[model samples]
Target chain A: MIQLRNALDVFTLVMLIVTIVLLIYTMSVMLMQRGKGKTPTNPKVVTKVRCVQNDYSAERDFSKGDYVGLEIGKCPKCGDTLKVEAIYAVGGPKEKDQPL
Target chain B: MDAGSSSDTWYLILLLMFAISFILNFTDIPQRIQLWRFASYIRRRLIQMDEIESDVRRRLINYLGKLNINSPKDVVDNFMNNYFLIEPVDIEPIDIIKRLSHLINVRDTNVKTYAERYMPGIQKSERYNAIVALEIASAINLVNKVLKHYFKLGLKNNNWVLLMQLALEMPNIIRIVNSYSKALDAFFSGTPIGDGAGPLLVRYLVGNSEPKRIAEDTVYYETLINGRRVYAIKAEGPGANVGKPGEAVEKLVDMLGGNVSRIVTVDAALKLEIEDTGEVAEGVGAAIGDIGPEKIGIERAATKYGIPLDAVVIKMSLEEAINTMTKEVYDGVLKAFERVKNTINSVGEGGSIIVIGVGNTVGVL
Candidate 1:
C-alpha cells in the first residue's frame, strides 16, 4: 500500500525501472557477444601440390620453410614432378552469410 | 497525510527537480558528463594502441639484437622517427609521375641504406626482411603517435566532438594495427603474404627458368605460354619487397623494341564489403597499386608500344592483403593465372606478351 509522498519517491521509482532495464539490456548484449564467440586467431594453413603432367593434386598441413616453387617429389598419378602450387591460410572468420 | 496534501508535495518537489535539471542543462555540466564518458572509452583504446606499439617495438629490438646490431634501440628509434617520404607536388600536374618515381627511388635507397648501415654483411634477403619489420614497427609507432596527439588535443580543448570521432574510429584503427601485428609474424617467418598472389602466379608461370634482373629489386623470366613467348616479371623474392615493376616493364618494352603484343598485370585488389574473398575480376588498366610511379610505368609502356593492356585482379580485404595468404585468395590467384593464359592465347601465336605480377614479392621465387 505504498504511495508516492513526494517527487523523491517518484524519482526513485523511475530510477529503479531505468536501472532494471539497463541491467537487462547489458545482460542480453553480453550474452549475445558471448554466443558470437571469437573467430580463430591463428588459422591452420596448408600447402597444395599439383602434378603438372596430370590431373593429380594433394594437400598437406603447412610446414615451416615451405615456399612456392618448391618441388616436393614425383607425382604418383603421372610420375611427373609434384610442385607446390599454393600455400595459404584456411578457416578464418566465417563469411557473413553463415549464421552464428 | 491526505491524498490532496500528498499531491501538493509531489508537485512542489517536481518543480524543484525541473529547476535543477534546467539549470544544469544551461551550464556546461551535461556536456562535461558526455565528454567524460567518451574520454574514458577513448582512453581504453589508447592504452590498447600503446600496448600494441610497445609490443612491436620490443619485437623489432629483439630481432635487431639477434642480427648483432650494436645498438638496436637507437637504430629502431632513429628509423621510426626518420623514415618518411615527402611526396612531390602535383599542382602543376606536368611530369608528376616522373617526379614521384624519382622520390620513390630515393625513398627506397634511403631505406636500403638504413638497413645496410645496421646489418652490413647480412644476406640481402635477411636485410629485406629487417627493412619490412622496421617499416611495420614504424607504422605502428606512427599510428600511436597520431592517435595520442589527437587524444591529448581533444582533452586539452575539451572537444567532445573530436573525442567522439576518435572513439568511433578506434575499432578500425585497432583492427588495422592488429593485422599489422600479425603481418610481423608472417614477415619474421618469411611466410608468403596475401599480396604475393601476383608473384606466386608469376613463379608458377616461369617454372624453373632462370630469372634475369630486370630492374632494381625486380626480375623477369622468358618463358612460353600456349606457344606464345611470355616474359614473366615479378619483384625479386623470398624477401619482403615490392620492386619497381613499372620501371621494369618500361625497360623491358624498350629492350624488346616495341615487339610486345600485350601486357597483362596481375595484382590483389581490395574487395568491397559485400564481396567474397578470392573473387577474381578482369579490368582494363594497370593492376599495380602504387602512388603513381608503378601504375604509370605499365601504362606508358603499353601506350608507347600500342600494346593492349589487360589487368586481372584477385579480390581480398586489406587485412588479408597484408597478413599471410588465405586459401581463398590463393585459389583466386590460380584462377587469374588461367585468365592470364587465356589473354595471352588471344594474341597471335609466336607473339610476345609481358606479364607483370605486381605485388610485394615475399616468400615467393
Candidate 2:
C-alpha cells in the first residue's frame, strides 16, 4: 500500500509540474505577443519606370495613380516618355521591420 | 506488500479515482474548466479580429474621404452592411450557370451604380478602386460580425464544443482577416496584387496595340507573335476588377466564326504548402476561378469550337494572391509570360489563337 501510494504521488507530482510548465509557456507567449505591439504593417512599395526611347530605367517610391502602361513624364536622361513598368511591395513577412 | 494489503490498495486507488471522476462529472467541473479555457483563447482572437475590422473601416473611410461625397462613412456602412448576393438555387441545376451569371452581373452593376451615385464625375478607374476598397471592408466586417455572433451564442448557451471549435479555428480566421486588411493598402495605392500576374503577362504581350472593349470591363488586343495572329484578352485595369474573360472569349469566338485554333489561359493558382511561391506551372483546361458562369462559358466556347485549351499558371498562396505583388510573384509572372508565348508558338498548323489572361487586373494595363 505504501509503494502504491508513493507511485500515485509521484505521478500526480509529475502531472502538476507539466501543468505549471504549460501555464508558464502560454502566459509567456501571450506576454511576448503583447510586447510586440499590434501596429498594422505598411510594406515598402516601389514603382519601376522605363524610358520609351532609351533603355534608361529607374525605381521610385510608389505613388497613387502609378500603374503599368501609364506614361509618367519625360525621362531626365533621355528626354523621352517614361512609362511605369511595375509596382510591387518589397521584403517578406519575416523581415525584422515587417512583422506581418 | 502482503496480498490483503495489495488488494486493499487496489480497491482504494480505484475508489479514489471513481470518486474524483464522479465529483467532476456530477458538478460539471471538467467541462466548465474546458469552456473557460476555450473562451479565453477565443476572446483573444476576437480582440484581434475587432482591431482588423476597425482598421479596414478607417482605411476605407480615408480613401472615400478624398472623393466628392457627402458622407463617406455612410457609403461604406451601406456597402458593408447591406451588400450581399443570394446564390442561385442548384436543386434543379438547369440553366444554373446562366442564372449565376445574371446574378453576378446585377450585383456588379449595383455596386458600380452605388459608387457612381456618391462619387459623381470621378474617373472610372478611381470608381473601380473605391468599389474594391468597399468590398475589402465588407469582407472584414462580415468575418468579424459572424465570429462575434457565434462567440456570444456559444457563451450564452454554455456550448463547450462550439467554443472549442471556434478556438481551434481562430488562428486561420485571424490570418485571413489580416491578409484582407493588407489587401486594402494594395488596392488604395493602386499596386498590382499577386493575382495580377496574368494581366501583367498579357500586358507584356500586347504592347502598344489598341485594345477593343470586348466584354464588360474586358478588352482584347490583336497582336502578332512569331507571325501568328494572337488575340490577347485581359481585364481593363489599374483598378481592382477581374473582368468577364469567359464572355469575351465566347463573343470573340462567335465574331471569328470559330476560327480560333487554340485558347491559352494564364492565371495565378493556389499552391500546395510544400510548393514554392511563384512557381510557373502548365496544365490543360481553362484556368479561371469563377463561381460557375465564367468558367463554364469558357469551357463551352472551347468545346463548341474544338480548340485546344492550354493553361499556364503562377502558383501562390491565397494570402499572396490578395496582397500586393511581391518580387517573387513578379518573377513568376515573367516566367509564365515566356511559357505562354511558347505555348502560342508550339502549334505546327497555324491558326488564329486566343490567349486569355484570367485574373483580377488591378494595377495592370
User: Model 1, range A40-99, lDDT digits (tens) per residue?
Assistant: 556787888888875899889877656777788899988889887777888877545643
Candidate 2 collision pairs: none
If you superpose only chain B onto the true chain B, what TM-score does each candidate give?
0.95, 0.93
Native interface contacts kept by each candidate, as a fraction = 0.46, 0.67
Candidate 2, what DockQ?
0.50
**Candidate 1 residue pairs that clash:** none
Best by TM-score: 1
Task: In model 2, state the lDDT of residue A59.
Answer: 91
> How far off is residue B305 in model 1, in Å?
2.8
Write down the RMSD of candidate 1 (Cα, Å): 3.0
TM-score for all models, in order of appearance: 0.90, 0.89
Please give the clash total of every predicted structure, in order: 0, 0
- Deviating ranges (above 4 Å) for candidate 1: A1-15, A31-39, A49-58, A71-82, A95-100, B13-17, B20-25, B67-70
The 0-to-1 C-alpha lDDT of every candidate, in the order given, reads 0.87, 0.87
> Which candidate comes out best when scored by DockQ?
2
Question: B274-337 in candidate 2: lDDT tens per residue?
Answer: 7778899998999998887888888989999898888998998898899889888998998998
